[model samples]
Target: MTVAVEFIVNQLKQVLLEEQVSTNETVRQLHGKDESHHALSLPDIVVFPRSTADVSAILKIAHVERVPVVPFGVGSSLEGNAIPIAHGISIDFSEMNAILEIRPDDLLVKVQPGVTRSQLNKELKKHGLQFTVDPGADATLGGMAATNASGTTAVRYGVMRDQVRDLEVVLSDGSVIHTGNLAAKSSSGYHLNGLFVGSEGTLGCFTELTLQVYGIPEFVTAGRAIFGTVADAVSAVTALLQAGIAIGRVELVDEDSIQQANIYNETAFAEKPTLFLEFHGNEAGMQEDIAFTEAIFEDFNCLSVEFEQDNAARNKLWEARHSLAYAYIHAYPGKKLMSTDVCVPISKLAETISYAREQLDIAELAGGIVGHVGDGNFHALLMLNPNDPQEQAKADHFNEQIVQYALLRGGTCTGEHGVGIGKMKYQSTEHGAALAAMKSIKTALDPYNIMNPGKIFT
Candidate 1:
């Protein structure tokens, strides 16, 4: 083991500075795992690559050495997307974090993969622009793109894959390629940007990324509508969407999730199923939308609707929804979070959520259902005792039922989490022959199967 370490370290140091390549146990452990319950596997070494050239060099050496390479960001991925199961070399991209350019004219921004979505939003705000994808983790843009992540705002803005215009990737053979052109819309070859954005580092490492940005809306309204039941809340969303409400963000926080939020944050939210809504438009149009939504809310048995006129209040209103994950972690100390995400068609939203709730209850799983319901996507946040196999099985059973329900209703296994290690078991069941096509693509690109192996596929 030390002999392999000695040879690799010497070669890596020749390309990167000795300090940039680390073999410290603490460092290796840090790079090995993500924020998931999956068993941790330590990388033999962690390499910090600052530029595309640095990444290319590392890939070249690793490819020649037949060593696996895992591209890491902030380790915010809920699935085991970033974990190094093969324990080869972990290339941490945090040092490459940079906003390279902001083209206001084209509504585009160029950035290195390591920059966080929040960081980009801050810079974009100065120019009256915003990066629309909000995965809610302040996650590195690369990881967000890798997971094809979305959040509350995705109802209107879209997922990370939708915002990407171009990607500068370092292939497994150490060759560099641009997966996309900077054009707004392209009818060109293969749409490699889409292929790579959710590849979860199995295809290549994203060195630089170009994304579309949006101008800040003139009037942004945020609110929460309390409903008699989760079905009512979901139905109201579907009604509003059908009515063409032009809603920006719409989320569902169940009563139990609200209870957890209230307990953790010391806030008073109605102990009922709720729909957190937001609309982006001019004042008059927003007022029209508000009235229309209110009328629809009443039709769906909404108990109360409260709107936040100011930014601070809007952020405060969204606090409960954003804090749901942390609240669960806080509620069950030492237990790991196993959030299950499944998306169904809009027509099946209410039934899908209701089914998840009923299944969780019947299974006696410690979980709550919360989601970006407007997108027909939701997560069952299940807290599992790390040491208890029976409890873990309950959580797994609950998750499987949810997936089965969604799949039967023409839904995919995961909406935004991508095909991480956690979801690999569902790939064959979910994609069938298409999964073989994906594996073929993976083979064509990485051939060596060294790029984040044991992820996507078993």
Candidate 2:
């Protein structure tokens, strides 16, 4: 470790609580990386901050010493967002996890950044409330805010940014500030909340978050629609979204994905390009909404549409969707999974998916395409042998091609996954001149670049 990193580590060990500070305990392999396709790099020390004060103190020392400090949570990020690439202090917020307060009437909750989505949901269940942003992984709320993560539910409910009403942040100089107020809407100056939500820990460390929540719906409905080709499934999704359906979730899974899911999940789903869908509302309203959705899918040449009426079947349907990435991981034990996310407008959904499918075919790679199609976002999981240089190169080439296609067609390189190390190369192309503005903001808040360095803008 460098002298600066050592000094910071020693300072943390001196001031932080025993449960919070550990150089020997923190230098483990699991803390070194995330779910992304990036190499692992361990931090010299790890600090688990229990409160805003703890984070402030750690930030103050790190700022003075110019040592990199990465905020870590569940480490479920898909873009190397939590990796301590600069080797300084890794702040694991797991100790700070506490659902501080819940407002059942207003449907909002105040929580520590360290809290995981599932943990928060468990607490909210008492009040018949739920947090809507489900990113498949049991990611930490802080990491999700940093990455501005969204998932299947984002099609209707919105992403982490939308759910977050207020954020308590600790800046580079250890100054603490709240980004927004408790009001439902704001026409305030400079939208700092928006600026920091997806900052990827470049701006500040999230201390606490006040997020929007929803009461559990009276009724829930789930369905599956299989199509002849991936293109047909894509077209059906685009059509459903255009028809103004109040869809809770709509995910697309290609035939190969179903095959992998069957192999890994040990369940039999029809091996075809399919759309897994859900709706939330009153029983009558949900039924009408689903009926309209079925009609649209039929119009788009859907081969078959099936509904799951029981709770067990509905849960199983979503479990299958959420398990897709893991299924791919299981399919290749020794190999790694390379996932590329590209989100286009609803109108361009079919074209983008078709183009991606065609490219995959041309490359002759065994990959699976799945996504929250209602939002025009999708991912192609390219399973590859990382040790094989040629295989790695091909995977990289395929990722680059898909990203380029998305950028050219006015889509982002990453939709939900933040611009961690994997997406940094495409920052300029994705944001154009605005990329400089982001860099400026990063420099302004983190002049030392100690907070999660080598992520987003690098």
Candidate 3:
């Protein structure tokens, strides 16, 4: 180890328990990368902080040393947001995981950074509540907040930023602050909650979060709609939304994705462009919505529409949908998944997806198209042989084309996945002159660039 890093490590060991701090190669390596296809970069050391005070202390030491500090949760971020690219201190939050509070009456929950989505829901189940901003993985709440992640339910429940009522953040200089409060709405002060939630930890480290939750719906029904083409499926989603159908969740998976799901999950679903759907309401209201959705899908040339009210069947259906990513990974052994996340206007989703399919075909890459189409966000799961430079180049070009297409159409380069290293190149084009403002904010908040450096900016 470098003498500088060694000295920093010694300084950290003074404030933390010996077991909480480690310079071991295995621990450092584990903290080096997330679930992204981006290259791994190891940190100098890994520290487990048990409380907000512990996190503050770690940041104080790192700030004094002018060392980069990356906040890490369960390392499930798809864009390498948790990767310590600058090779400094990696602050792992596993030890700090605790569901601090659940105010059922207020529909709010307080949790430490390490608590995962499923863990929270499991406890909330007893109180007939659910935290609905699911990104499909059992990712930690802190990591989810960092990325401003959203998945199928975002169309109805809103994204991570909407759920975050308050954040206890440790700034770059080790000063702790709460970005928001428990109040439902506020016109007070600058909106720091929005700034910190999706900052990818570049501005501060989240120690605790106060989030909005929802009561479990009284009636739930799931459906699978088949269409002749991807365009028809996407068009159906748009029509449903325009018709004001209250969809709980709506996801689109193309023929390739369905085939992968069938092969991996061993289910006999049709190999066609499909929409996995769900509705939430009173039984009468849900039935009305489902009827409207079916009629709309039929109008869009849907081949078949099937609905299931059984909980087991609904869970099984979602399980297949959630497993789509793993299915692609399992199908392409030795190939890493490089998924593209792009969102467009709901009116433009059909054409955008058509363009994506065309680009995927032209690129001649093995990939599948899937999306939470209810909100005009979708992904192209491109599988590339990481060892093959030529293949990697092709995938890169493919991703760039899709992102650029979305940007030109007034859409975001990344709909949900935070700008980790993957989508950093397109930020200027996406944000235009506004990027300067973002940089100024970053510099003002984290002058040393110690918080998750080399993310969301070049």
* Residue range with the least summed lDDT across 10 consecutive positions in model 3: 290-299
Model 1, range 1-458, lDDT digits (tens) per residue? 59998799899999999889999999998987898778899999899998899999999999999999999999988888999999999999999999999999999999999999889999999999999888778899999988899988898988988999999999998999998877889887898988998899999999999999999999999988999999999998999889988899999999999999999988898989988888999999899989999999999999999999888888887877888899999999988999888999999989999999999999897879999998999999999899999999888888888898898999989998777887888888888899899999999999999999999995
Per-residue lDDT of candidate 3, residues 358-433 (tens digit) = 9999999999899999999999999999999999999888888889899999999998998999889999999889
Q: What is the C-alpha lDDT profile of model 2 across 404-457, one tens digit per residue?
A: 988888889998998889889998887789989888888888888888888887
Worst-scoring 10-residue span by lDDT in model 2:
21-30
Index of the highest-lDDT prediction = 3
Clashes of 2: 0
lDDT for each of the candidates? 0.91, 0.87, 0.92
lDDT of 2: 0.87
Error of 3 at 379 (Å): 0.3
In order of appearance, the predictions have TM-scores of 0.99, 0.97, 0.99
User: Candidate 2: which stretches are off by over 4 Å?
Assistant: 1-4
- Clashes by residue pair, model 3: none
